[model samples]
Target: MALDKQDLLFAGLMGSKAVNLIQNANIVNNELINRVLPVIPFLPVKNEKNNVTSKSGHAINAEDNWTTRDSIEDQKQFFPLSFSFKENGQKWLFPYEPMINIASGNSIVKRNVAKQGDKLIGTIKERWSRKDFDITVTGVLIGSIMQGKPEDCFPREHFSKLFEFLKHSKEIFIYCHPLDLISVNKVVVEDYSFPFTKGENVQAYELKLTSDYSYELLIKDDF
Candidate 1:
């Protein structure tokens, strides 16, 4: 079968390579707020929400006050973003998008129900709570300490900020995507380990972050 020019162009558009360039990571220390991370490079981290936790169908009746009372909780819809930065007029893009793994930030809504003799009756109690995020970053770039290599790697000085953040216990706002940012109040380094290979430095990191109280998603034109 012969393909027309329009058909080839349509296929190309469908398979276009999309890139999410990271702009900056916002942070705060003492009086300094919205401080950007010194070391910026492209990282592969997918933004997604974890499975929600909920309880349903306590009672068979749907209309009864005591009927199936379920407490449902879920995180707001947000995308995880890979980090990226430019140095020396060169644009660095991450090859893989799954190297950095972010466990979803969880939030829950509580509900109350009461039942008397199989007929459930209870006043609804509503409450919301936001949880923290457990992030694991593993890739060649994270452990790369080589200087002058801006392609698919980062420097040791840049990685040092992770340790400094742990020591100072500073809070940071991660601009995961252009539309939204992961604002965390406390960043605790849970674990840091890596292996030394022949001419290769590979590292793994575990971090626990406290969720922010509030945030606003802004459009690029408005921001």
Candidate 2:
């Protein structure tokens, strides 16, 4: 007996779902999430096979060997901040003076000095660096409030601040655990691509926040 077209379509859908479930399960079991956590920096390293070993078991290719000097040179700097309700007690103080300028083609730099009264904050210096791709972000955990109240959440205010800061930023970074799944439902930023990198046993995401801020987030494993 021949199966109906609807039945075949339903079977195909079920098969697709099954394949997706298996793929997802494999991803989870392999702990791919830990590799993409935004807070952690991923540095590329030279493979050991490339090393030339002498009779003394010492690597002869010193210049080609992986060293801190080269690693530091290739290092991509990133900064991220987390806010919580417990830290600030109640009030939120957001006194930020951003030095990043996209039009000027300069890297963001910030300096702080103690004063008698309120803190003095402003851009002290701005200059373009050869390492323009290197980015630094500082997140101030501007206290959090109860989630029960709509006003307390300050969703719009928080989004506004993020928008203003990311207006010139190339990317935004986020950190999460393997179990910490995220949804794009309420995210305000637009025009961005997320590239996820996996480690030997974990997963992470490198978010290119263009038209936004670019950053990385590594998903941690449950201990």
The window of 10 residues in a row where model 2 has the poorest summed lDDT is 68-77
Q: What's the true lDDT of residue 4 in model 1?
A: 50
Q: Write the per-residue lDDT of candidate 2 for residues 98-163, one digit (tens) a residue.
A: 111121144556554456255545545554443222222222111122122333322345444444
lDDT per residue (tens digit) for residues 1-223 in model 1? 4445533432232222111111111112211111211122122232234222222232322222111101111122123223322112222222222124556654656566645445656544476555666665443223322212333233354346445554544344343442244543223455654433222222333344433344568746754
Per model, how many backbone clashes are there?
Answer: 5, 27
Overall lDDT per candidate, in order of appearance: 0.33, 0.28
Model 1: residues >4 Å from true position, as ranges?
Answer: 1-115, 121-126, 142-155, 178-200, 214-223
- Model 2 residue runs over 4 Å out of place are 1-22, 25-146, 154-157, 169-223
Please state the error at residue 214 of candidate 2 in Å. 17
